[model samples]
Target: MRFTFMCKKDMVPIAGPHGRGKIAIVGAGPAGLAASGYLVCQGYEVDVYDKLPLPGGLMSFAIPSFRISINSIIEGVEDLRDNFSVKFILNTKVFKRDTVRRDEGDEFTKNTVDLRELLNNYDAILIATGTWKSRKMNIPGEDSKGVYTALEYLFLLKSYELGYLNHEPPKANKVIVVGGGLSAIDAAEVMIHRGADEVYLVYRRTINEAPAGSFEINRLRRLGVKWMELAAPKRIIADATGNVKEVELIKMKLGEPDESGRPRPIPIEGSEFTIEADMVIEAVGEIATSPFPDQEYLGIKQDRRGRIIVNDELRTGNEKVFAAGDVVSGPSKVGRAIFLGLNAARNIHLYLTTKRISKGGT
Candidate 1:
């Protein structure tokens, strides 16, 4: 679907807030944007920071533009800028807690403020940093030139489609995608669309155990994307030039159900084979990056999975701090992240303006 682009001046902004209480939101993705939206409604000053030049986080680069229009993302940001007095700081990395703290206090006390400063300066702080660290295959020759994480490949494809990058898509006529999740399907489909002669999806389980939704699976079938079910990649074979040429896979069978009530794959003997492919894309998953390391020192709390622990009200253990989106819920759908962000904004407003917790004891 083609998206119509509107000039910056043409977009409408929310008129409720003119920037009152200071709010620092890390990560300018859907979650951060949503939270900023709600916070502005409550008359809070919001500043959105991101490491990337453009916002939208994973939604802007990790997914295809055909699936989620870049114009729509830009429009969302533009709308926020028009209505709310939210300022965007791009290409800024909040690497240390000190940088956040310093920025919050003096706004210019140091070159970069630390996290402690952020906790102290703003009336409230929200961490919405999305997971960007990709899981490695840990297989031999995975460092080969033609091996790429799903995010890298998708980002390149999106950049090329957006005319930001110059290069032919990797010349892999035959491609094998590792993993059975939604990312696997996305990579496989994109490869086929980009003229890969053949695309194979290698998963370590049957379709039932695959993490992809049924509709996505059906779409793959419709696109003639081949599936090598019950197969796990053991290693990547590389040529002398350090470019991947083939993938070694192990066939497996379902074992007894594990704690998650899902059967695990058990490797089968004498079922090893090699699939020739010019490139391999690993779509395993992503790990979250901890924005607040001294949580205990700062009296902040997080869940076992490293997600910021929040009550029903979306406030973190630190009364002055709030978190939402993937940072608080781990990896999840954009819709859910936005929902949580909006809720957090509302709660923040209640606390700042009304001096009352917005129910559920946030």
Candidate 2:
């Protein structure tokens, strides 16, 4: 979607300086970049900060290279950098709310920066940090050495694929992937491509509940990745080396539909079984838990899921702050985040330039 910051002819030049207001955007992913693009177009100086050495967040690490070419992402970022007055602060994390707050003291705190200081320095701030926390199964032996979250495994694989790692690939032969979502399929496919001798996708429900699109599921089957449906992993069995050796599973049957409108899987009595594998990967989902506390602080509010709450204009309760992407909407597709980023950027530009909020706060 196209996003522009041009004002109506009658409402031009009423807010502040033209293209002179400073804006800080957290996270260098699609949302952050998109916001930067629109803000820059409207004459705002934009600086993007990220914890990673590179931009693109999950798009750069979690997604397989085959699905999204690295060159394309680089080109997009480069375009924004060249055309817009955009600065990137990589390898720097905004760990605490104070990091973005205005400083009351001259000295810096450990792993914390003053948010108030940032507010005084910049005209506005945009929070676009995407969800990086992985959800755990809470099952036994989950802490086993060979167990990995989907993002962790994918990040390592993509890093290796991008020449960030020179060592031999991790040993993952006879691997079992838990979950039926797109991430689960991607992890399974990558494991096989990376030389896993056997790959099995274990799902707690039927294929209908799998997160993989039909076309992708068909492709996986064609590629020979085995699917164990109606199976729930109960525990990870490890050997003396603390490496996963087998997984205990319980057979499940479909019951009443759950909140997602999908039939819930009910564990069957005395229907336990075991599958031997060298490694296990969990691809359930991700959560957005800000390093900052959820209570009222700096005029920001968090929803029940711990995502920052924002209005339609992407503004938080605080007038000077805005938010977008996964940090506000929870884990979602990259394209959706980009769309919201653009919208948020435009709204921010409008507010900064006209001093009047538009229909959409963002």
Q: What TM-score, over all chains together, does every model reach?
A: 0.86, 0.87
lDDT of each: 0.74, 0.76
Candidate 1's residue-wise lDDT over 59-91, tens digit each? 886777667888888887876776565788876
Please identify model 1 stretches exceeding 4 Å from their true place: 1-19, 97-113, 160-169, 292-297, 302-305, 354-362
Global CA lDDT computed for model 1: 0.74
Model 1 weakest 10-residue run by lDDT: 101-110
**Most TM-score-accurate candidate:** 2
Give the per-residue lDDT digits (tens) of candidate 2, residues 1-362.
12223323343322333457889888777788778767766667788877666677778767888788888877767655654436777766665653342211111123344456667788888888777777789999999988998877887776666666565347677999998888898999888787888899888988877767667777887888888899989999999999898999999999999998999999999999999998999988877644355454578778766688888788887788888998888878788998889888877877887888533231
Error of 2 at 171 (Å): 2.9
What lDDT score is found at residue 268 in candidate 2? 99
Q: Given candidate 1, what's the lDDT at residue 355? A: 69
